[model samples]
Target: MNQPSPKRRGRFITLEGGEGAGKSTQVEGLKRFLEDQGIALVTTREPGGTPVAEAIRGLLLSRDHPAMHPDTELLLMFAARAEHLRTLILPALEAGRWVLCDRFTDATYAYQGGGRGVDPARIAALEVWVQGPVRPDLTLLLDMDVKTGLARARGRSEADRFEQEAVEFFERVREAYLERARSEPARYRIIDASRSVEAVAGDLQQAVSSLMGTGQGT
Candidate 1:
C-alpha cells in the first residue's frame, strides 16, 4: 500500500490594526506560542517579506513623497502584495507551514479605501486579481482609539506617510477595520488593544487555542 501523504496546506493568519496597536510584539508572542504547539510556521510582514516587496514598502512609507497620488499609493500596495503572496506566503502554505503575516489586503481596504477615499469596488477587484482564492483564515484586529494609538505610535518612531495623516484619516481607517471585522465575525477576532499587554496576550492566547482546537484540517 502507498504511504499516506502529509498535509500540504496550512492555515493563514494575519494581524491588522491602525498605528501603535503593538502588532509586532503580539506577532512575536504568537510565533513562540504556535511553535510550542508543534506547528510549522512562517512569520512575515506586508509590503515586505521579499526584496521586491520591501523596496515597494520603502516607497510607500517614505515621508518625502507627500505629493504621491492616492491611486499611485494604492497600486504600489497591491504590487507589493502580489510579490509578497506569490514569493513568500503561497509557497510556505503549500509546504504545510502556517503563515503569520503582520498585515494583508484588509489593510488596503482600511487604508486606501477608507483613509485615502479609494473606491472599495476597485480594491475588491485588485484583491481578487492578485490573491485569487487565497484569503486569511484568521485576522486579529487590534482595535484601539485613534488618538491613543497615534500618540503611542508617534512616541515610538517618526511618522511614516500613512502615520503622518491627520487624526481624521486614522479614524476612518479604524472604522474601516471595525466594519470589516463586524461583517466577517467568523474570520476576525477584534481585540481591544486599550488593555495592558498582559491582558492582550491572554486574549491572543485564547484565540489561538480556539483556532487550534477547531482543527480545520489545513
Candidate 2:
C-alpha cells in the first residue's frame, strides 16, 4: 500500500477588538487582500459560521432576553466556538485553506472576563477545555478608544447585547485586549484604528505582510 500524503495545515489569523473598532470592515479588506495574493482561505466570525453557532450568536446578541448571567454568556461563547471549530474552521485549515476570523478566544477574555468582571482564570479554564491546543497564529488587535468605537457602533445602527454595555465596561474590555497583546507580542499586531480607512488598511497590509513572507505557502 502507498503511504498517504502528509497534510498541509493552514494558517489561522484572527482580528480582535472592542465594539465598533471597524473589525468587520478591516476583515473584509484583509480578506480581499489575501485572496488577491492567490491564497485559498475562509473568512468567518466567532459565535457564528455554522448553523448551530449562528443560533448561539443570536442568543448571545439578542436584546430581547433579560440580562444574561456572565457565566451563561461565557459558556455559550465556548459552546459556539466548539461547534465553529469542529465543523468549519478546523476542517478548512486541515484542507490547507487559511482561516481568517473576526474574533476568537481573546474576545472571550475581554468581554466576559474584563468587561463582565468574571475571573480570567475561569475563562482560561474553559479555553483549555474547549480548544485544547488550537489558537490563532496571528491576532491583529485594532486599537481605538472605547468611547469613539462605541460612538461609531451606535451611529451605524441599534446596539446589540454586547454593544449595550456602558463606557466603563468597554474601557475594561479594551484594556484586557491590549494587555493580551502585550503579553503575547509575537502572535499579535496592534493597529491604530482611529486613523482613516485607507491609512488603517495600509497598516493592515503591512502587518499581515509578515505572515505573507515571500509567497502564499509562507
Candidate 3:
C-alpha cells in the first residue's frame, strides 16, 4: 500500500478593524494566548510582512508623497498582497504554522472599496487573480464608535494619509466591515473594541477557543 504523507495545514486567522480599534494590541495578546495553548503561529501585518511588500506599504501610508490615484492605489495594494502571500502567509500556513495577521484583503474591501469608492466587484476580481482560494479561516473584527476610534488614533500618533481622511471616510470603512461580517457570520467574530484591553482580550480568547478543538478558532 502506498503511504500518504500527513498534512495538517495551519489555520489562518486575521484581525481587522477601523482606525484606533486596537487591532495591534489584540494581535499581541492573541499571540500570547495561542502560545500558552501550545499552538505555534506567526503574526504579520498586511501591505507588509516582506521587504518588497513593506516598501509598497510605505508608499501607501506616506503623506510626504503625492496621493496615488484610486485605481493606482488599489493595484498597489494587491501588488503588496501578492508579495506578502507568496513570501510569508502561504508558506507559514503550508508548514503547519498558524498565521495571525493584523489585516488582510478585507481591509482593502473596507478601505479601498468602501472608503475610496472603488467597486467591490473589481476588488473581488483582483482577489481571485492574486489569491486563488486562500482566505482566512477566521476573522476577528474589533468594532467601535467611529469618533472614538479616530480620537484614539489621533492620540497614538501622527495621522497617515489614510488616517487623515474625514470621519465620513471611516464611517464607510466601518460599515463595510460590518456588512462583510453580516454576510459571513461563520468566518467572522465581531468584538466590541470600545471596551478595555483586558475585556477585549478575554473576548478574543473566547472567539478563538473553538478552533482549538471544536473548530472555528482558525
Candidate 4:
C-alpha cells in the first residue's frame, strides 16, 4: 500500500509599522531567537526579495526623479510584491520553512493609501490582485507616535522619499495600521514600540510565541 507523505505546515510572520518604528530591530531580534531555538526560518524584506523586486526598489528609493505619481508608486510596490511572493516567499512556505518578512501588503495600504492619499478602493483592488490567498499568518504591528518615530528616523539618515513625508502623512499611516489591526484582531498583534527596546522585544517575542502555540521562555 502506497502512503502519502506528511504535509508541510508553514507559517508566515510579518512585521508592520511606519518608518523608524523599530520594526527592523524587532524582526532581527525575533529571527535570531527563532533560529537559536532551531526553528526553520527564512528572513527577507519586501521590494527586494527577488531580483525583479530589487530593481523596483531602486526606483522607489531614487527620490530625485522628479514627481513620481502616487498611482505609479502604488503599482510599483505591488509589482515588486507580486514578484517577491511568487519567487521567494511562496516557495519557502511550501518547503515548510517559517518566513519572517519585514513588511507586506499592509505596508502598501498604509503608505500609499493612507500616507500618499491614494484611494483605498484602488489599493484594495491591487492587494486582491497581488496577494490573493497568500497572506501573513501573523502581523506584528509596531505601534508608536509619529513624531517620535520620525525623530528616530531622522537620526538614522537623510530621510528617503516616503520617510521625508509630512508628520501628518505618517500619522494617517499609523491610524491605517491600527485600524487594520483592530479589524483583523485574530491575525494582528499590536506591540508598543514606544517602550524600551528590550521591552518591545519581549512583547514581540510573546506575541509570536503565542501565535505558534509555544510557551514563552526565550
lDDT winner: 3
Clashes (backbone N, CA, C under 3 Å), per candidate, total 0, 0, 1, 0
| Model 3 per-residue lDDT tens digits across residues 130-214 | 8877788889999999999999999999999899898999999999999999999999999999999999999999988868765
Off by over 4 Å in 3: 1-8, 214-218
lDDT of 2: 0.87
The candidate 1 region of ten consecutive residues with least summed lDDT is 1-10
C-alpha RMSD for every candidate: 4.5, 4.0, 4.1, 5.1
Q: Which stretches of candidate 4 lie over 4 Å from their true place?
A: 1-8, 213-218
Root-mean-square deviation of candidate 4: 5.1
Could you estimate the TM-score for every candidate?
0.94, 0.93, 0.94, 0.91
RMSD in angstroms, candidate 2? 4.0
Pairs clashing within candidate 4? none
Q: What does the lDDT read for residue 188 in candidate 1?
A: 95
Candidate 2 minimal-lDDT segment of 10 residues: 1-10
Q: Which residue ranges in model 2 land beyond 4 Å of their true spot?
A: 1-8, 214-218
Candidates' lDDT values, in order?
0.88, 0.87, 0.89, 0.83
lDDT of 2 by residue, 1-218 (tens): 22222243788899999988898988888888989988788999987989999999999999987589999999999999988988888788888899999999999999998999999999998887777767787899999998999999999999998888779999999999999999999999999999998899999888877876534332
| Alpha-carbon shift of residue 9 in model 1 (angstroms) | 1.1
Better of 1 and 3 by lDDT: 3
